[model samples]
Target: MALLKRDFIPVSKQQNMKPLHYPDCIHLSERCGCDLLSISECKGESCSFCQSAAQQELSQREWLSILNTLGLEQQKKIAGKYYSGKMPWKSQQKKG
Candidate 1:
């Protein structure tokens, strides 16, 4: 069967799929990362609309764990290139 427009999720949508049990965040629909239309990248604990701190923390941890899968040198390179050697998550850890 041929697919319809609504039947096909964009690649961007596939990347920014909302976390399970995440709230219907206003920013999700307002500032979407997918086509800049459906939902914005989740801000986790930084989002004002986040309903549950525990859920946000868990989600952030999961995302961070993905980076941990990378080799130590590759991770360091990414940290230096993108994060200027100061990881944002580490700062948040200090704050929380």
Candidate 2:
């Protein structure tokens, strides 16, 4: 029921050359053991993360597709957890 390395997400950095920030650092997924992109900062895109057997080529939509493919249960759980039962949230919080 956790978003392990199989659900790793790309880490994005701020605009001022600061460290990358994860919007949801408390979720089970944030603990994913995937290697982060540390060599260079993300341009908000043009970066990627590997989720176990699946590698997302730096598209947020692609990552979400993987979750949806995990099955309806997972998709619902994720949507209820972070999306506020709506489109992706611009802010990260357990709104619903």
Candidate 3:
């Protein structure tokens, strides 16, 4: 008899996949390196919406997900490139 525990209880239907349950498939790009991509590229510089043509850009969640798999130094480099521009983020905005 194996030592691995087996659940005799029937799995509940409530245990369904989340809306964002995307499998980790890897893709390599000259600009972004290896990424777990569903949609191909980032749209309108981090703008995400429903459309085929607008699906080129990576979503914000995808960017952050890719970042989590990266080293600190590489993360810094990527962040630098994106944030260096006129980012509309509140953090980049000056407080008066």
Report the Cα RMSD per candidate: 14.0, 15.1, 16.5
- Please provide, for model 3 over 11-92, each residue's C-alpha lDDT reduced to its tens digit, 9 standing for 90 to 100: 4677743232121222323332224345464232232332222233345445545656678677667667986733333332
lDDT of each: 0.52, 0.40, 0.39
Q: Of the candidates shown, which would achieve the greatest TM-score relative to the real structure?
A: 1
Which whole-number lDDT from 0 to 100 does residue 13 have in model 3?
A: 70
Candidate 1 residue-wise lDDT, 1-96, digit = tens:
211112223457448543332244333432333322344555533555544445567788876777767787877888899999866755555565
Q: Model 1: runs farther than 4 Å from truth? A: 1-23, 26-59, 90-96
Kindly list the per-residue Cα lDDT of model 2 for residues 1-96, writing each as its tens digit. 213222334455643333433322122133332236443322222223323222233344566556645766766677787877754532322232
Using lDDT as the measure, which candidate wins? 1
TM-scores for the candidates: 0.35, 0.28, 0.27
Q: lDDT-based ranking, best first?
A: 1, 2, 3
RMSD of 1: 14.0
